[model samples]
Target chain A: MPQCSNCQFQNMPGTTHCGRCGASLLLATALIDVHPPRATRWSKTWRKSRFWHIWHSLNHLSADLARRVDVSYPSSWPSILAAVRLIVPGWPQLAGSKVNLGRFLLGGYLSCGLLAAVCYGTTIGSFFIAVAITIHSIGLYDVAQSSSKVRAVRISRILLGCGLIGLFLYLPLFNLVPQYAAPFAIRVNREPLRVGDVLLSNRNAYVWARPRVGDIVLYELNPVRVPAFEQGRNAVLNLAGQRVDRVLAVPGQSIVCDGRTLTVDGQPSPHRPLNLTFSSLQVSLIVPPDHYFIIPSGERIDGLLPNNENIVRTLSLIPITQIEGRVYWRNYPWSRMGRIR
Target chain B: MARFRKLELGKGLPGDSNPDGPSGNEQAGCLELAVEQRRCGNYENALRLYSRALEDDKSLVTGWLGQVQMLIMLDESVEAELWSRKALELFPGNGDLLAGRAQAFRRMGDKGQALLLSDGALKSAGQSAYRWMVRGELMIVIGQETHLHCFDKAVQIDQDWLVPLEIALIYRDLGAPSRALGRIRRTVELAPDRYYAWFVQGQVERDLGLEAAAIKSWRHCLELCHGHVDAERELAQLEAGGWSVGRVWRRLFGNR
Candidate 1:
């Protein structure tokens, strides 16, 4: 029986036309050859190049391994590709053909990252960064689950994958997050930074810029032995720790403070140490080239010492290197949460 | 009123000729039945029969080959590959078994291994239609121009209508409808009585965008094999305005 190519109406073997559609039965079958074009001279030369040789070898090696494992599952290749693209959250999901989930994850990841960057030195920024990392980790796990050939993935492989991703994320973020913003808790009562108050300090605040006057700076102090009235006994207390203070004078400036009134190079200065009462009636100093004049917060050191001149001088001049960071924002005690003035 | 006939004890009823229970030709009968079931596209039934035949005679290479081929047709390529390896260990360097394994690998998406095993099949001995068909499929996968020549060689080796039909199916599966049409035309001309050939012709024509031709082909197929569900569904889909939006989307983007 001969079937019409146009209408597929069966007819006699020797018929010239279809009985139903009236189309010709003897039409030649059009052969559409899909043979690839012959290699050109440039292509031939490129195929012999070192890079191409390496690529070809790698291709052969991977094909051999795939054959050995019999990786024939429908999602195997996509899963593998997704694993490789795990650097970007939701990229693996997209590669593995989970389009909607991938898009949602990618959008969330990017939005969180943008927010973290925008709110770089705040508590909310840290929260956003944590959220972004969590999204990325979830994407990785999803890709791994989808790619696994067995229903129950091997415990060791899962652990290894997670460990590697954890290390990759931890290494950079461990250094980066603190450099931008680090949390500090006030231990003693100060005017603005009272006990139990949590604040954030920008550790990289003075990396490229100099600390200016009126900026509240956190700096380390040398050990000072101060007499303490503990249990009705005169006991010495070693004070060697970090302190937050206000910079009243920068390099090449002179500051004079008499009890309550203060002067910076013959002009009255508005910046004052919070909750501090100076014991010395006349205290004057010239800020050096690489130092700043800062009034340490809390009880004045002169009031605690019998001979307080040495301790005062030690506390007044703050070297640039010893300045740790700038106090930026108060995060805890929601009622008082705001930027530190 | 009807009376019941009396039953005999030693001598059974008139149609009960075989006095003995099991015969020596049981394994051969199983293989024959398996072939018939395979020809009818009952791959599961054929696989069961093939397994029965293998149990009776473990050394039967044809039974092993039949089982492997049935598994591949049933889309159990992993099992097929494993069984092929076990069979290969029993009958080392068997060309037909090698060709069967190559087909399994091809189904499993390992074209590189398929091509390698196909080459080994051709190199081993006994030129058969199956080995040539595997080579043609490998060529098609790699986009070689000589695929048509390989299919021609397969048809030349065996003039059975099943050969061209299988080739057409391979071409269809690999997304070469035009090439499949040429082989399907040969198949229909060779076996006009085979309803499946007409059904496949309808599918190929539909793939080529010849809606009228596909309808006529499906109608002819239904005439030969009445109440065929696949043919009826295809005809209904065509009559109801083919290519729904979702269908088109799946066709364009689905893994298939």
Candidate 2:
């Protein structure tokens, strides 16, 4: 047992510093037990460089590599992963080659882009496809080993990409999807729409109703001239991830947003007022018949009404018809991003 | 504060203005929405978004535009004009700024200068279709000398319905359906995607006493465009078999 010479922290034998405050515990031999030992404090838990954590991770990786490094791989493990190293889905069961990965990726990119172009055209769909294919190509690059098998797959992918491009070229002639699909679908541009979440009014939605609070909706704005993903990113998913916010407010529901707080019909939601500007907000709307003003949690404030001639004026009044659609899912972050709460 | 994390986006007004940092139109997106907020007369919101958007792409055009518009909406047009000028300096030949300036001039009762500046804009932007269209509109309102030149140029460039669109409007106002019909017919070809073109075609058919054709045109417009109040009324009239003079007047001007 050793007590820190400078501090009251007592430590076990051979302990160099006070577990509590890094004080020298080398000189004073004293009682080891002070209080019932609680789990080591957060700061004391890893006093030294967490080399063990790194060592553990590295060890796991080493084990994985060792497991794969077979003395006789082809003969022993007839596993999916082992097979995958040589081949991919929907490919001929020929002698699997390492080089095929690059070709597959190239093919995927070209095909996807071509298909998207054929389906959507250059303005919206083509551009998106091109970006998406490029993303898949990166993974393919990692697998290419310049073997003959890789060459064959590359050729196949190129053939597929060309077919897709050809389709795009003749899109109008072979238009598959109509101008509009499903007379009226409850599609929310904002996925994982929260219970009280609102989204940006998609200019592409309904004929009459202006978007209002209490309406869970799909928000799809007009195709931006320069899309968020375009020009700034090289990845298709990155481009697709751009989104607009939606709010849900109910009409005649004394909606109040007081700076950093909100109350909708006297019920405080999970979302609060954003204190950007208190003077311009008004969230009092009379929910139109058959339509709820779908308000995201924080859009209204006290004394903030839609007709008040301020930023929040729209929040004050919402027609039933303006409700676009309810939010159902969130497709980001993978973990926390799921169905709207 | 935790609650505000979720509501922050909801509170933001569309348009914002950031007059100092950069160009707005170049940035693109909600980042450029501040100018729209100003256009919609939400000044306080315009200011907030402008500040935020400026943080992203400082040289956003709409940010400055929003700021200027907000200043103007707040009855500080002088400051607004200064901000507008700064944005103009960034873009140099921005149609939006020119339009904003023209509006500012009109508000300030400087009609002569406003018209002159607008004219200069039209002449300088003789190659641009949107400019020509804007100029044609100004000329039509005041019967300026550049009307025929601007209108003809706009038509020559693409005529993609816009040129014929103007001609149709002119003829409609002049009570000349015969001429308007020719222009609208071309407009329909140029912009098949536009419901107004179809509606205009229906209008011409109605004026010519071709009830069946008018009904067909209206129905097609309604089918293609969807939720057109004018098409709805016209279809209703045809269904009822009793179209009135009042309805006609509203159809021609008010409903349109």
The sequence of per-residue lDDT tens digits that candidate 1 reaches over residues B1-256 is: 1343454357422223444421447667777888877765677788877766665455566777888888777766655776787667556667788999999788666787888899899997568998999899889888898988999999999999889988988998889999999999999999898888899999999999887789789989999989989999998888667556755664579622
lDDT string for model 1 (A52-155, tens) is 65765675565556554556645434434334467778876653335569889999999999887655545786799899888887776776676566755644
Task: Per model, state how many residue pairs clash.
Answer: 0, 74
Candidate 2 Cα outliers beyond 4 Å, as residue runs: A1-341, B1-96, B99-111, B123-126, B142-146, B158-163, B166-180, B203-213, B226-230, B237-256
**DockQ, cand. 2:** 0.00
Which 10 successive residues of model 1 chain B have the least lDDT summed? B13-22
* Model 2 alpha-carbon miss at residue B114, Å: 3.8
**Which 10-residue window in model 1 chain A sums to the lowest lDDT?**
A29-38
lDDT, candidate 1, residue A231?
A: 79
- For A168-287, candidate 2 gives per-residue lDDT tens digits of 533543343322221122233323333323222233344554544433354332221121233566322111112223454543455555435567778875542222243334444444
